[model samples]
Target: MFFADGLNCSNFDRAVFQELVDGGLGCVTVCLGFWEDAVASMDALGRFRDLVRANKDLVAIARTGAEIEAIAGSGRCALVIGYQNTAVLNGNIRFPELFADMGLRVLQLTYNNQNEFGGSCYEPQDSGISRFGREMIPELNRCGILIDLSHVGERTSLDVVELSEHPVAITHANPATLVPHLRNKSDTLIRALAARRGVIGLATYANICGEYGASPSKWADMVAWTVDLAGIGHVAIGTDHGRNVGMPDLTWMRQGNWSRIINYGAGNAARPGKVAEPGWIDTMKSFGAIATALAARGFSQDETALLMGGNWLRLYTEVFGETDAQKQLAA
Candidate 1:
């Protein structure tokens, strides 16, 4: 059975590559930078590209759904490059096509803090998408880059959902109804997302999953609930579990030269080096256990398979199938 993880921010090293290969994960949306500026973002992505090139046998950069499907069961995992924030774009309306051409298929409109795009979930005032952001949407759609609204403010997220011509995604967020975290989505948003035929990859981050965190059963049940709430084809796994393997770097992830005051996000003042995840669903390899849990939760085999990876594959194909000519013309 082919499994897909919505996101993996692990080190681009042989060990992590081997783990994905061993885990039987077909694809992962990789983080190039959390909050990098334009030139720095390009440089970081260049380095990641080098890593992929260096380990061609273990992973291949997948630009289209066909590429991801072709690489399935080929003893290697496909890397779907993405950005966690739009700071890298530096408010440039033209760069969406440029980055899309570079094979970065996913771009988040905002991170935990506001930029030119609009407000963040962490902001006091949730301003909706800015005028510049409104302008960028058409270009992003024209470029066939999938829009991710994971860390965006509630209003901005809704604005994007209404404005985007193509379906958008919340690639690594959970339902706030369950966890009540700032980063999680509301029931209204989830229902709207599904109505648009978009996908939401439920995140397995400790805080977002809940205080007790995610065991295989807990994880499965959360997914089952989301499936019931959003429909089966709209729920998938995006275990935001990358900080587990290496030295934790909240400073870079949270501050990132954006603020003078330390923003220890998620209200953890201690800023623990590593946030613990439940053992059963902690790593990439454990993703398949979700399938078992889904089946046990009374999901049919077909529904379980769709939740595992088929839904992600379907979304990927719909958004990335556009040809260069089509994108250019759409521009």
Candidate 2:
């Protein structure tokens, strides 16, 4: 079975795109905008669409499971447009439908800071989902947008999972039981997420992995433990991998416009930059190595398929609905 990467923060550079294509990914969710206002977000989406048009042979945009399957079947990468933050909404509820019409499929409720929607993991006190967030959740559900809570606070994440009609995602994080990082999810949250049939994409990002370090074997152990806790169906990969990322990009992701000084997110004064990715799975091309690692860890082909991409396809089908072709087939 083909696989999907739930979240890839890469700049979508041609070289990066080439690696994804070569890596044998059936589908990938790329970050289209984060911390951008509505206008700027639209512009970014336009540029991304242009990029797909320019490289039509290598990639195609997909908004549903059937489309993703068809694109991958044709030997092209299926790109799912997503946002790391809902800043693009600009406090307007109507924007969800607007972006969804434009082919957006995944929307993260909050990034590293609290916003109109809800509280963030970085916040000292999490107030849970705001009134606007409660209103926004249903709109997002009606529009078929997959809600994401990867960087949200505990109270807020639980609140969203409870309130959202459809299952949500913690698109790229590890278990805090293993790492104890604020960015990682706790046992309670993971169980709650799994109980609701949500998926938590296991991250290969180093800081959250903590002592797990760079070993593919260790990474597989992390995946195994998650499966043991959340069941095999609820775990998947969201590598958070990027290509040619620099300090400026890191600064922008961590600080945005909210902080005058460097926020040093997932970093400190001694190491104030992008955390080193596990060497084995550092780039898109190396992503397949994760499959081999899982196999070595005694996961069956069927189980590995679910972890690699089958589970994500199932989730996408649930939230985005099947395409006309699928409907016709069922009919």
Candidate 3:
């Protein structure tokens, strides 16, 4: 369901994703690109599109809660297209809508370094949204594209939260109450984002979770921090699990400015003590158990459901909900 690299729906191993879905992963915000070119990303999406057409019985793209609801009820998981970087847009405004049409519902503006849109969390400047980012906001708004600031710079995250006409999303991030990782959104930033009524997906990427993001509870600690700071409504589970392998897009970032010394996608393999550590979910743990733990963390059932998936669905309906054009398009 997390449309990872290589094994896009084209080379999709349904068995892997299906286990998650069958185990109750209602909707999966799948990744499509990290540092790919416009053509390559589009080619990747097109392949997914073809797969959707070929496998309508199992998977379907959903832009609305109704579709997601249908997918979940049918005992299949909903696929929400996502991108980890804007590089695939290739510095063009139109790509937001074009990719939106291709079903790219969620997008993180930058991966690790500066791009035309904004400074990366790893970039020296970290000033905020660039001219290209300013350009990207309105059009992404117009196209009903949900903005994700997960891997973007702190300043840029604040700016987009303020600049966007609709709520934005930090699809996968740690709350960052402690030291900042290139991908963790700080409490201040998370609160600022929460003020805009956005959705913040708690990721299971080991590097970002502390214990080098390798421990599931390290992930839980981040979520607990977000819950402490942003509250359950602003917190949600989002294991940034890619696939059998991490995306080459991350490899592509190394050619630019990778701060961490190891592979971002390795999860916990490279981290020395993580595997030996107790209860490090690595996000590979049964997602349902993750949900149960979140509930036990004092998250009320309503808020628990929201953080689990409802908030994301509501945020989607709010932004991509019923624009006059989208209404017509849906019609």
Candidate 4:
């Protein structure tokens, strides 16, 4: 789904998403923060709360599978709140339940750089989760919110997988196909996550592939590698699609930050092995591109479904604890 951000230029309005749903999307894991303070996030949350209330038919905050199904039954899509960073919490743990009530079901502890929670993948020191980070996990579990370790440090993520009572998700990431880079998880970490019943959202980002972003087919190759290592149930789709039409000057800011800068200014803007000819697109289109490539490589329908969205849906359902009523209805 189109994850519209602050730079959305247009209203961070419901209309943008209405357009995408009209265009055809199953569910959207919408963002509430990229880089903002507590008050700013609270403001955004209020706006979103109002938006959901105003357009109940068009948007409903679905924290679990049943809600998604209910929304889907009416021919609309589900909106799940996701925080790219823990900045809103801003070291205060009280916000979890507040945000959860505000429809925030997913949150990543850190963004590109380190915060109070722990070191970022981009940081020189790869220390794991801090005291506050460890302190937050049980609270997150208590509130029934899912943890997303996508951009967190290697140590921090492993620490979370071990500590979180609920299944954690690397909301948007890729398995090593094994070159070690900051963006992708190592095979060992993926196994640890899967063993703990956590979900891995295999990203189609160019950086995740390696120094060179691999081809679209290479993304499928990573999924295949991950499924082989952790099994299909642990794999899922998180397109990390940036509705670039709206949002910040990420390209410029990211250039100087966590990412190791490359020839971003020139035509070679892709992560590395990716299709440099054309750069970043939505994860679904990226998957569609992967499908054709995988077909040539003979990937079957079962595998394709797991890699696309099935595994992600299954994980979300299982981790969030669906009710018996939710089950009887979906059944």
Candidate 5:
């Protein structure tokens, strides 16, 4: 099976690329722009393009399933550039098309805070997707960008699924039924996503996993539980793994520039630092353990393959349209 990570938070560096290759990862979606404005976000995308160009032998940018398969076939990791927040749009409706042209494939509507698009799970009130957000959905679909609802509020996420012409994704979250974390989705939301043929990438972020963080076996149990809720076709892996990340990065990710005071994020005052990673799945190299655990939990090879990456590939094809490779096959 082709191994693809729905969300990996590691910075784009040669070492990180090498680790991805070494870990047998065929494709990975890496967040490039989060809270940056237009200019900064453009710079981030430019730098990402330059990095991929410089490491052509190691990785390639993939916007479609065919590209991902081709790049992986050539022994290079396919990198899918994603944004954790739509701040790069800066209220301009045309920015989705512009960013799509520039190779931004996956975009989350909101981060941990409320934005013009919609409310976030962390927000006290989820006012749902705004009119601007309503306008942006069709634009995103027209541009072939996947709408990700990993950090979006329940109402906003449901609103997106209902509004979008193409199926969306919860790129990195788990089942609220299993963990009850704010970042995890409720069974209703999961069922709603699956009803629209959207996929939910189960996350292994320790805080969100709660007691399941103890081991890979426990994590697989949570995966099984989610599969029962959303079905195997709508489940995948999105380890929110960040290599070499420290407190400063965590603080920035959680607080961004929205708050003057530090937000501990998923962690609280008692444990006010980087959330501890599960020892068994701590690094990029350790990702394959998920497959092993799934197999042990009675998931068949085909089901495990879907959970590993196949499900995400199907969603990518459905939302991003056909590439030259797919067109040829169709011919």
Candidate 6:
């Protein structure tokens, strides 16, 4: 089965990643940086590119679904470079094109706080997609970059669904109905996203998953519930796996220097807490357990395949269409 993680923040461990691919991972979207300015974003992109190049034998930068399929066929993993915020664009409309040229594909409009584009879920008030955000949508569409609303405010997420010409994704989130967390999504928003043929990725973060450390059964139940709500085709896997490296840990994701106080994402507002990786599917190698879990829940092989990766492949193929720059870069 081809597995695509919605978010992968794991510390670079080539041997471990290779082992995971050998076990059963196809593609993973790794964030370059969020809350970064243009220059820093480019720098991060360069480093990521270098990492891919260094491990070219085991992985390749996947800019298209065909490439992903081909790479998986070769028993290697495909890396899709994604960004968690548009701060890299720096309000410059031209940056999306530049990022696309640099092999950046998925881009979340905002993180957990307000930016030039819109409000974040953490904000007391959601301003929704701003004028500049409205302008960026078309350009992002044209550049063949997939729009993600994983960390956006509720209103902003809805606004994106209404405004985007192409289907947008909440690439890594759980249903709030089950967990009742801010990071999780409501049924209305999930349905709205599905109506436009957009996909919703089931998040693996414990807080969003409604437990400090969830079991495979719990995750499977959530996936089944999501499929029931959004249709089988609209559900996919986006494990928000964080890099376990203490040297460069998740401090950037939570704090980002956006706030003097630690902004514990998915954790409660009172204090920060670490998201202990679930025992069953902690690493990418264990991703196949999800398929087994689905099977146990009476999901057919086709349905299991869809949840594993086919749905994501369909969404990416459609959203990240063949633009001139993409074609040229491929050549």
1-331: candidate 2 lDDT, tens digit per residue: 6979999988886777788889999999999877999999999999999999988888999989889999999988899989999998999999998898889999999999999989999999999999999999999999889999999999999999999999999999999999888899999999999989899998888877876656888899999999999999999998877678789998889988878986877777988877777778777888788899999999999999999999999999899985435569999
lDDT string for model 4 (169-208, tens) is 8877776556566767888788999998887876544444
Mind giving the per-residue lDDT tens digits that candidate 6 earns over 1-331?
A: 6777767767666775685586588888888887789999999888877877888888888888888888888888888889899888888999899889888899999997898999898889999889998999999999889999999999999999999999989888899888887788999999999999999989787767776237777789889889999999999988887645452356677778666776567776553556667888767778888889889988999899999988898999898887575679999
Candidate 1 CA-lDDT value: 0.83
Write candidate 5's Cα lDDT for 1-331 as tens digits.
Answer: 7898999998778988998888889999999867899899999889888988999999999988788889999999999989999898998999888888788899999999999999999999999999999899999998889999999999999999999989999999888887887888989899999999999998888878888878889989999888888899999988888887888888788888878997877788988887767889777777788889999999999999999999989998788886435569989
Question: Highest lDDT, which number?
Answer: 2
Model 1: residues with Cα > 4 Å off, grouped in runs: 243-248, 323-331
Q: How close is candidate 3 to the true structure, as a TM-score?
A: 0.83
Q: Give the CA lDDT, 0 to 100, for residue 196 in model 3.
A: 80
Q: In candidate 4, residue 294 scores what lDDT?
A: 47
Pick by TM-score: 1 or 5, better one: 5
TM-score of each: 0.94, 0.96, 0.83, 0.78, 0.96, 0.94
Please give the ranking of all candidate structures by TM-score, highest first, separated by commas: 2, 5, 6, 1, 3, 4
Give lDDT per model, in order: 0.83, 0.90, 0.67, 0.66, 0.89, 0.84
Put down candidate 1 lDDT per residue, 1-331, tens digits, no spaces: 6688887766668778878887888998998888778899899889988888898998998888888977876778999989999887877788887888888898899898888878899998989999998999888888878899888889999999899988899998898988888999999999988888899998877767784254677777788788889998899888877734533466688778767886766646674455776688666767777888888888899988898899999999988876576569989
Query: In candidate 3, where is summed lDDT lowest over 10 consecutive residues?
Result: 1-10
Candidate 5 error regions (>4 Å): 322-331
What's the true lDDT of residue 183 in model 3?
63
Model 6 worst lDDT run, 10 consecutive residues:
242-251
Q: What's model 2's overall lDDT?
A: 0.90
